[model samples]
Target: MHNITNGPKVIGTKQTLRALNKGIVETIYVAKDAQKQITLRAQELAQSQDVPIVFIDSMEELAKACHVEVKTATAALIKN
Candidate 1:
């Protein structure tokens, strides 16, 4: 059984990025087929924040993890 809640942290781009910059991001998961620019930005953000990045098989999985319907990309920022 796959569980997004127990899997990892999840965040968006705009507001979420701010949180990430504040050291709230633990790990990030992007859709494998996400936009190149968005993915690149996420990569950069993760790198700058020293967070790990992973590409899941589908956006659906990422969305579900983010508690959305169809999110193209998402960042896992959990509070420690």
Candidate 2:
């Protein structure tokens, strides 16, 4: 599998949702302490789209994975 963890395709919640609707998202990562409603919505969206979801321990971890300083949530969209 491609290492999107440090690639240029990482996106935030809004963009992620848009990508999800387009069937471009492969997986989503949510911070453990993220808002319940947001996480739930993301889960529902991913489930409906058949995309995988992961919950990380912190925003810092998600940021690291996305190669950013900090990220509350993100989704790794399919490359091309």
Give the range of the ten consecutive residues with the poorest summed lDDT in model 1: 1-10
Q: List, residue by residue over 1-80, the lDDT tens digit for candidate 2.
A: 22557554655777777777777777777778767776677778899877878778877677777777756565564646
Writing each residue's lDDT as its tens digit, candidate 1 over 15-51 gives: 4566677777777777787777766776787898777
Global lDDT scores for all candidate models? 0.67, 0.70
Best candidate according to lDDT: 2
71: Cα error in model 1, Å: 2.4
Query: Residue 36 deviation, candidate 1, in Å?
Result: 1.3
Candidate 1: deviation at residue 79, Å? 2.8
Q: What is the C-alpha RMSD of each candidate to the true structure, in Å?
A: 2.6, 2.5
